[model samples]
Target: MKRIWKQVQQTLRILGAGILAILVLVSSTVPGGERLEQVRAYTRGVEFDYAGWMLAALWDKGQQWALSAPRYWDEKTQRQVVEDWAALTREVQALRAESARIFADPSVSDPQTAAAPVLARLRAREAEQARLGALSEEILQIQTRAVLAEMGLTYGKQAVPSVLYRISKLPLALVVSPREVIRQDANISLLPDMGLDEITALEQRVEQELGVSALVVQIGGVAVYPAMVMETTNLVYLTDTVAHEWTHNYLTLRPLGMLYDASPELRSMNETAASLAGKEIGLRVLERYYPDLVPPPPAP
Candidate 1:
């Protein structure tokens, strides 16, 4: 039993190393020129902590594996959990909107008093939402892996690197493109909750200092170990983003994905390929499981 436990630890360490290698590969894709460093300087204080996030995520994954919780839960339970989460998400959204309206209403002098009920309800739902949300993410990962396996995209009866993702508040990306032409030269991740004023200031600084077009864009997902996906109630979009980011991971091991930073053409090809494959995989998952939620075919 001691030996077996050691083997598990060894496996996890190897997996952690592999994830780190992928991060390095992605960071090296773009040339580290003066302009890139200049942009980094602006984002130095606000950059997302990939290392810390990865460590926390790996620990979470370890807990899930130890419990084997989702595997024991029958299909009915899984479906019910996902459904409850979705319903709860919609309710939370409505509560938030109402709370905003109450606070914004000029007539409501004591906005806090007016919004107390909504706030209380929101606080009450937080625990359940966290539980259901985590389970839903795990279920979707399994479903996506099953779809990939069916598509012959898996080896050794598993999707390479396995399908892993976490739905969270995603980080914002600062993309820098030369004004002379439209091409991505640098993409830096920033704090998810960074203020709009700060983002605007950074973008303006980068553009003015480097003479390049800079934009702080909201990203739905990012290719990281246990890929980062934005929190959303829309199941279809959620699944699609998961598959999309996973596709990038899939490509990372192959020549096409490895050459993603070789040239503008290669980058475009890699992205387009991931986009197409992600959509196909996402639709297949929906068709097999959430058929009712699947979008209808477009008119001819």
Candidate 2:
């Protein structure tokens, strides 16, 4: 009887040690699982803050300039663009507020105590925004010059026509097209010096093979996709698209993404920041080259 009791105690002791070992392994691995989420959140916070500031500053400057210029644009179109700008500004402010709340949350831990590294990342994004903005401005100036030359030939004076921008949508994809002054049916056949039918067929086949719901396509510098947002071919637009997509990639690496499965509000905040940044950088380009084409002021 005593021998049997001793054997039972030994078995229980072994089981207890096994349980303890498992607990230790889990504790060590669990923190790592959450680390990625924390980092993604941190990066997003930085992006939102910087983007909001840039856009607000750009809009203020642009609006003031527009107000001082002669009335060149149609009243309806001008009002519409001004309204869009106001809406975008509101969105940026909301994103900034949300980002601040996330940063302040103690539950979301940032292991990196030093703010220096974070600041460096922000600066890099800013520099990238500046470079892309310059490129966009250069392209706009070229287009504007072309418009002026055409006007001179026909009317002996420059006339600013309506500028219209659009994005075409396809399943699971986006395409950015160039800005057009007059609306017309897109000439799919002449796009990109490639066979339009063949490319469309290929895209369909690829989508079927990959089982994706949609694809993005660029036609004349405008982006088209089924996604909720309008797309653009502008370098600044592309930069923001790339940045937003990259945030998704970064989130996948973190614990919050894993744990939260990318909550709706989180995704909104992410996209909003990217959108704001794109517009901010895009406007900087406009200001540098098309100074006469300044964005109008928000409605009172």
Candidate 3:
């Protein structure tokens, strides 16, 4: 038993090293090495910690794997968890709005006092959200893998890169374009918690200093290993984004994804392919597991 445990630990260590190497290689491929450095200088302190996030996500996955928690639950229980997660997300959003209203009202002398109950409830809901969020994410990953396997988008009954993701606050992307031409020069990730004012300020500074067109874009998902999926209440969007990122991972091992930065045309092809495949896979997952949530066909 002890030897088996050690082997498991060794395997995970090797896997961690491999994932780190892949991410680093991809980062090194950012167009214009010097230009990437320039962008990094401005984003030095505020850059998203990819390594840290990956480690945290992997640790969570390891915990889940050890317990095999989702396997214990039947299909019905899994569906219920997903539904509850969506409803709880809405409840949390409404609570946030109420809390904001109370705090923002000029007539309220003691906003904190008035907002105390709402805040308390918000905290409780958020805690529950975290719990359900983790479980639901795993459930969705398993479902997606099964669907992909059926579609023959798998090898040896497993996804090529494996379906791993975490639904959390996603990082903001800083896209740089040449002033004279509308071309992407650099794309970098910023810390997730940055506010609009900070995002605007950074974009302005980068543009002014580099004489380039810059935009801070909110991405629904990023194709990182254990892909970074944005937290959302919409199940359809969530599932679609997950599959979309997974497609990117799938393509990464092929010539298409390998040459993703080869040309603007290739970039378009890669994205279009992912988008199309993601929607199809997402729809199939819904049709099989969450049939009620699937939207009806359009009028003829």
Candidate 4:
């Protein structure tokens, strides 16, 4: 693990330096360099994730873990597993929301850091996550592939076979706002494996060095980035986001996606086009699997 991390760090340094230059030059002279930074972020895409170089160094170990995991959900119990997962996930979200509400209370001594109550809430969250993860593997496998096949985005073994992942995303997003603004607005996506502390430190360093507004957004389902392991009991979003990212993967090989970095308008076009296609594809999945959730087509 130590050796792998060393290699990953070396790669990050190289990537950050190279990409930062592109940002500094691409319309950096503009008002606050926000658009330039946004371009730099979007163009870089998920280079540190699934198709990135860092994972190439550790794919064998990662694949071994993924393929070797034991199955907890089968065809017979698939529906039950999904239903249970959905319940637990909602419970977890409620607990998190409560915790967030508590932290946001200005009356507290310090909300930025976790307090005793927050720690208790964290424990509850972890318990719910453990239950959710128990049956997640089988559920994700069946659901993601079904959506992919329904959307006609499948590849044989020769092209690419059996993508099994053991973890969710670890996106280290470096969000930059216009100097004239006060909040985060743009970002460059980082590797899925980067440590939280490491990424947070980088966010701070970048902000201080560049004298720009910067922060790290450590969340998931971001359209601009790639997630290694994507699974959710929320069928609606799960189907839509999976198709959305895959559309990006497809576009990367075409003319529009290839020249994404050359112009701002081109990047917008790529996102807009992918969104429309993904919505259509998501509707197809809805019609087949969960007809009740399907929205009626617009008036003709």
Task: Go through the candidates in order and give each one's C-alpha lDDT.
Answer: 0.80, 0.35, 0.84, 0.54
Candidate with better TM-score, 2 vs 4: 4
True lDDT of residue 147, candidate 2: 43
Tens digits of per-residue lDDT for model 2, 74-143: 4344434433433444444454455566567777677234334555555555455443333332233233
Better of 3 and 4 by lDDT: 3
Once model 2 is optimally superposed onto the true structure by TM-score, how far is the C-alpha of residue 6 displaced, in angstroms?
A: 84
Model 4, span 39-136: residue lDDT tens: 45433543344234223323432333344332334444665565677777776667677777878888977775655666677688777776556455
TM-score of 3: 0.89
Q: Candidate 4 local accuracy as lDDT?
A: 0.54
Residue pairs in candidate 3 whose N, alpha carbon or C atoms collide under 3 angstroms: none
- Judged by TM-score relative to the true structure, which candidate is superior, 1 or 4? 1
Candidate 3, 144-254: lDDT as tens digits: 999999999888876777788898788888999899998887888888889899999999999999999999988888776778897788888888989999998788777
Compared with the true structure, model 2 gives a TM-score of 0.23
RMSD of each: 2.9, 27.6, 2.9, 10.2
Per candidate, the number of residue pairs that clash is 0, 31, 0, 0
> Residue 14's C-alpha lDDT in candidate 3?
36
Per-prediction TM-score:
0.89, 0.23, 0.89, 0.54
| Model 3 steric clash total | 0
CA deviation > 4 Å runs, candidate 4: 1-76, 103-125, 128-131, 134-138, 157-234, 298-300
On residues 126-235, what C-alpha lDDT tens digit does candidate 1 reach at each position?
Answer: 67787788888778887888888888989866787778888778888889999989888888888899998998899898888889999999978877777888778888
